[model samples]
Target: MKIRCLIIDDETLAHDVIESYIKEFPLIELVRKCNNAIEALEALQQEGNIQLLFLDIKMPGLSGINLLKSLPKAPDIIFTTAYPQHAVEGFELNAVDYLLKPFSFERFLLAVNKVRHKIELESRSAAAQGYFTVKADKRIHKLNFEDVTYMNSIGDYLKIFLKNGKVIITGETLKSIEESLPSNLFLRIHKSYIVAVSSILYIEGNQLVIAGASLPIGLKYKDQVIDRFA
Candidate 1:
C-alpha cells in the first residue's frame, strides 16, 4: 500500500514545492495539505490513518513543535522550515529528517527515503515481536501471538479466543485474519477455525485438542495437519 502523506505549511509556495517534489514518488500519496497546525490537527483527527507528515516548524499560531507535542501518537514527521535552529528540537521529537527552506528535490527525496526506511524498520520489528494490532469495540487492540489460542468464524465476524478465557469479536473474515497471522505460529485446520500451532495439545483422528477444547480438522486439511506434525 502507498504511504499516505499530509503537508502542513502556512506558505503557498512551500506547499507547491513540496507537492511538486512528492509527485516523483509513486509510493507516497498526498492525502491533504493544511495551511496551519490547526487545520492539520482537524485533518488528523478525522482521517486517523495518515502515515507521514511534511511539517513546517514555525507557523503563525500553533507551531509545528507544539502540534507534535499535543498529539498522543504522532505519525512519522519530516520537518521542513526556513530556520535551522529548530532542527535540534525536531530531532528530539524523533522526526525522520529535517529539511531547511529552499531545499532541492534531491534533499526532499533523501528525507522521504529516511521516512520509508524508518517505517520499514518499525514494521519488521513489530513482526519479529509477534505483535499485531486489530480494531475491536471502537478501539485498537494490540495482541501477541502467544496470547491467542485459536480463532473461530461466525458469519461475517471473527471470535478470537485468548489464553486468558477472553474472546474478542471483530468484523473480519477468517481468510483475512489467517493471512495476517504468522504461518509458523498459526495453522488453519478448518474453514472456520484456525488454531495456534503451539497451543495444540494433541490430535485424535480428524480432530485436534487445543486449550482444552476439541476442534475439527477439515477433511481436505487433515493431511496437511498431519504433515505439519510429521
Candidate 2:
C-alpha cells in the first residue's frame, strides 16, 4: 500500500526539493505542499486524512513540532530540521525518523524505509491476530485489543489502563500505540491520550470523564469528540 504524504514548510525551495524527492518513489502520493500549518490544516480538512508529514521544525508562526501536537489525529512525522538539539524532543514527539537538515536524497529514502517497515508490520499484525503487543523488560507482550480502556502518555512513558483496573506502563509513543490498537475502538482525544469510546462516561469541557478521571480533550480534537458523542 502507498503512503500518502504532505510537506509542510515555508520555503519554496524546500518544498520543491522535497517534492522532487517524493516523486522518485511510486509508493508515495503528494497530497499537498502547504506553506504553513494553517494552510495544511485547511487542506487536511478538505481532503480528509494523510498518512505522513515531512515537517520542518522551525517555521514562521506555528512551529512544526507544535503543529503535530495540535492535530486531532496525529500522523507519522519525520522531522527535517537543521538543529541537532531538537532530535531528542522530536523523538519524544514520536517522530518516525529524524533527518538532519542538508540531508541527501539517499538519506531521505532511508527515513521513508523506516516508516514503510512500521506500516507493513502494523498491517501484517492487524491481519494475522486480534491482539496488540506491548514491549516491557526486553520482551513483547500481547494483549487482546478489547481489554484496553484508554492509554495515557506521561512524559516519555505510556500507560495502558485496562477495563479490569489492571495497567501496564511502557516507554512507547501514544502514536505507535494508537496505530497498533484497533482503529474502530480507539479515538485520539489529546496529544497524550487515546480512549476507547465505550469507556467514556461523558465530556466535561475539554476533559473526558473516563474511568473516574478527567482527561483533557485536545483543542484540535474537541469538535470530533463532540460529534462522536452527539
Q: Which number leads on TM-score?
A: 1
- Give TM per candidate: 0.62, 0.56
Tens-digit lDDT track of model 2 for 1-230: 35768998888888888899998976676878999888878876654336799999888999988898898777789888888988998999899999987889999999999988877776666746778889966878888767878888899998989888989889887766766664446677777788887788988887899777889998756766776677
lDDT of each: 0.84, 0.80
Which stretches of model 1 miss by more than 4 angstroms?
133-230
- Candidate 1, residue 145: lDDT: 87
Find the 10 residues in a row with the least total lDDT in model 1.
175-184
lDDT of 1 at 177: 65
In angstroms, give how far residue 107 of model 1 lies from its true place: 0.3
Clashing pairs in 2: 206-217
Query: Which pairs clash inside model 1?
Result: none
